[model samples]
Target: MEKNVKQIVEQVIKDVEVKNPGQSEFHQTIEEVLTSLIPVLEKNPAYVDAKILDRLVEPERQIMFRVPWVDDKGEIQVNRGFRVQFNSAIGPYKGGLRFHPSVNLSIIKFLGFEQIFKNSLTGLPIGGGKGGSDFDPKGKSDNEIMKFCQSFMTELYRHIGPNVDVPAGDIGVGGREIGYLYGQYKRIRNANDQGVLTGKGLTYGGSLARTQATGFGIIYFVEEMLKEAGKTINGQTVVISGAGNVAIYAVKKAQELGAKVVAMCDSSGYIFDEDGIDLPLVQQIKEIERKRIKEYAVRKPSAKYFEGNKGIWTVKADVVIPCATQNEIDLNDAKIIVENGTFAVGEGANMPCTNEAEQYFLEKGILLAPSKAANAGGVATSALEMTQNSMRLSWSFEEVDEKLHGIMVNIFKNTRDAAKEYGFEGNYLVGANIAGFIKVADAMMAQGIV
Candidate 1:
């Protein structure tokens, strides 16, 4: 039986690889999830017989279009946009819209695929979908960004709605970008569908703490993990990658929990402060001024800035959190982190650690919190915003934050219980995969194959 299960897993992966050629990221994610499901498949032969894995690997619908907008120079700029409605068994499609130069079919599919399981883990009624464009917002004027967003939404508005498909923000997309997209969506649809989008400005229908949800959720989940292991965040030295929203708020929450966040990074480079990072100063530079992280070293003379971002992982610390983009931590980075005696790793970004790196961490007995479970705070809170929008009401910061914290705790418990049940006692990577997969798989099976 075990042999048959392993063969099925391998065969399915080979087929997916052939079909999804050149989509390395998508293939990587699929392989990781499938590898963890050997025990599940062995225990539940019905899933294999029904070909549920085959159906899950494929998206329900994939949309692609060209977005052409005018720049400030009176010239036209064209970019590609994509939306992969990966699954809808649980509910309508729900995910973020990323705006970066790296946006492509494979990346969108990978993100959407991950979202299916992540949303399932949240126990929210939202399904998984992701849409974005290769439109880089950096260095662009506000008017240029508005023009691009409007053009992007002119076509996207027809596909999404308050219930059909709701898009939030990710990567380069933030409150400002969400506002621009929502405005255009409203103009075209001629409806005040506040629930159609999330990450909105508070006055317009956004939820409080949505901005800090992901970061705070990471800390909350990590706290649960530490508690189960008879540990705590107090007095721990922490290093976080990416000075963006996720990283910034993770620093704040970790600090609030008595952890000293000594380092954080951006695309330009990393800043290391021996005396602990100044959260307010980081917010001023990254959020208010939108400047590079190197500015942090300039403002605080005691800190030093490195010329590259990857070096941030090599610094010695008790805890490591990668809140940056995908595949940021490779095997080499993993080796360095483990060598530095880091006791725990929490992924605040999607697939930040490659397969080999993740295995190494687990082998070293590092308490690993997978991204699907750790960084789910953002999407979970987005769902909360959707609820508020549906009810035509707003939640106070405390109200929303308390809900977010409870959700994170529940997610941690779910992941931990699933891991223990699957015989991978402390393997969160496997735990997260199995726990998230069971919910979606059961829903798909019950729905009778869409």
Candidate 2:
């Protein structure tokens, strides 16, 4: 059975690689998930017989279009847009819309593929999908950003609905962008289907605490991990990458839990402050002013700024959370982190650690939180937002937060139990993959080959 599973996984991957040439990110994600499913296939031969893995890798729908809009300079700007509805076995497709220059089909597919397991672990009714464009919002005026979003949604709005696919904010997409997209969606549809979108402004139908859900959720999962190891986040020195919504809020929650976040970064550079990161200052620089992280050092003379983003991993800390992009931490960074006596790593971003880096952490018996389970808070809360939208009611901040915390705790338990049952205890990568895969696979099987 083990041999059969191995052959099956290899064959599927080989086929995928041939079909998806140059999509390294997508191939990496599929390899990671398939590697963890061997134990699962050994136990449940039905999944293999049904060729579920084959179906799982293929997206249900892939939409690619050109987004053309006028910039502040009155020039015609065009960008590539994509939406990969990876899976809808459990429920309607749901994910975020990222707007960055790095957004490509491979990146979108990778995110959408990860979203399948991540959404499954959330215990929400939401399925998996991801949409984004190579439209970089940085340095764009508000009017320009709004126009671009409007044009992007003009086509996207046709495929998504309250009961179909719901898109939210990610990376360059935020409240302002969501508002523009949602406005366009509403205008085109000629109806108030607020549930068609997740992240929205409060004046409309956005959920409270949704903005902070992913960051807060990462901390909650980390807390559960610490508890299992007879440790706590309290008094821990933490280093987090990215100064975006996820990193900022993760820093806030970690600090509230008695952890001092020493360093954070942007695309240009990183800032390290031994006195602990100033949350307000970071918010002002990254959120309000939309400036680089080096401005953080300028504001606080005590904080030191580094020119390179990768060097932030070299800082000595007990915990490291990569809220940045995929493969941000490679094997070298992983070794440096391990050598610095880092005890734990919680990935707040999807596939933040390379395969080698992840293996090194697991081999050293470090507590590693896989992104599928650890960073599921955002989508989980988005599902909650969907529920509220459908019922025409809103949940209080405390109520939504309480539910988010409970879901994160349950996700940890699910991953732990799955790992132990599969004889891979403490291997969260395998645990999360198997746990999330089982849910989606079961649902897919029940629905038949669709």
Candidate 3:
């Protein structure tokens, strides 16, 4: 923490220090936002004068539980589950619940903290929250998944509702995972509460365009920026990281706009298809076929797959969409990316780049959009799902998609305007930090001190 900023916030700092023994990720999230929002507090005296910072950083509720289920061999497996409802001033707690092996309280808190601002930037009525577990879903049997989800929801259903914390999906938790969780929620609650969850199967209460919402939303935001700058995605060579849901849709939309997606990756390795990646093959493999990205070479024999731990940042391109995990691209990778003529980086995942990587981009005047701003599409659509549920009506695919486009466009403009106001001139971290801080901070101030 910086001395001057820490000095001003010493009281709140002490409170947090006493409460938290060693949750580094959670502390990092808080320190980052608190360090940046000093200017916001200066202008909005109600924020500082009222101690809004303290309240905004704390979670409204944190739920922790154990999920015990029988695996295929009739073996008992126990895993921890968590949900950190970070805020509710703007709207209900809306976010995703990942089911990866890496899920933890610290990670969820960091994600939920970032979500508060991300949801605010969408200009939608959604508050920040996130949940997940350390349960590894990979290679798990369908029966095991059903049992695990049922056991997880057995305890989780008590904490969630339509107007309360509504979790969708993240990393390992997708439509299938959401379906299992939703089914359990319904069975336990004995109510057909459609609003209790988002990211359902379209055959059920799922919204249209929800599948491609986050990925398409990234392109939608970039398109708005490009339109304002009198440029376009047409003819741009893009390097996209990750072969997941967000990355696949980003590739599809960029190609639709005539951009050439040259690279994409997975945990095993990255693939570079100079002739342009086949978006359909990617969709088929990752989504439908449910296989590794190395299969891409099998489909298109010309595609090059580089094994080992390397990321996609080494690819030379005009735009870099980091759709991978946090810290996937570091300072060295940032330099390589900038040296390779990369002009913009739109984060498709949460904190995919390190602080140094971000600083390198900002110093070089690259168009760096933070994950909170760039990847709010999923939660934004989740909010739309809640709206439909509350109204007892479902919107058509086109309707929800158009609304998504409008919201993304608005978010881009807000970030741009905030940057210009802060003298950061297109520094999206500052822009997004300031823009999102204002709304929640104001609401917190008006509510008065607790």
Model 1 lDDT, residue 186, Cα: 88
Global lDDT of each candidate: 0.94, 0.95, 0.85
Can you write out model 1's per-residue Cα lDDT over 1-450, one digit (the tens) per residue? 999889988999999999988999999999999989999999999999889899999999999999999998999999998999999989899999999999899999999999999999999999999999999999999999999999999999988998899999999999999999999998988889999999999989999999999999999999899999999999999999999999999999999999999999999899999999999999999999999999999989999999999999989999999999999999999999999999999999999999889998998899999999999999999999999999999989999999999999999999999999989998888998999999999999998968
What lDDT tens digits, residue by residue, belong to model 3 across residues 1-450? 235445776667567757876776677667766766766666556555576777776799999999999998989999999999999988889899999998888889989999999999998878889999999988997889889999999999999998888899889888888899999899888998999899988866888888899999998887776676677788999998888889999999899999999999999998999999988888889888789898998889999988853657788899888887877888999999999998888888998887778888989988887888888888899888888878878899899989998889889889989978867776778888899988887776666664
Cα error, candidate 2, residue 255 (Å):
0.4
Backbone-clash count (model 2): 0
TM-score of 2: 0.99
How well does candidate 3 score on lDDT at residue 179?
A: 92
TM-score of 3: 0.96
Deviating ranges (above 4 Å) for candidate 1 = none
Model 1 clash pairs are none
Poorest 10 consecutive residues by lDDT, candidate 3: 1-10
Q: Which digits, one per residue and each the tens of the lDDT, describe model 2 over residues 53-159? A: 99999999999999999987889999999999999999999999999898999999999999999999998888899999999888888999999999999999989
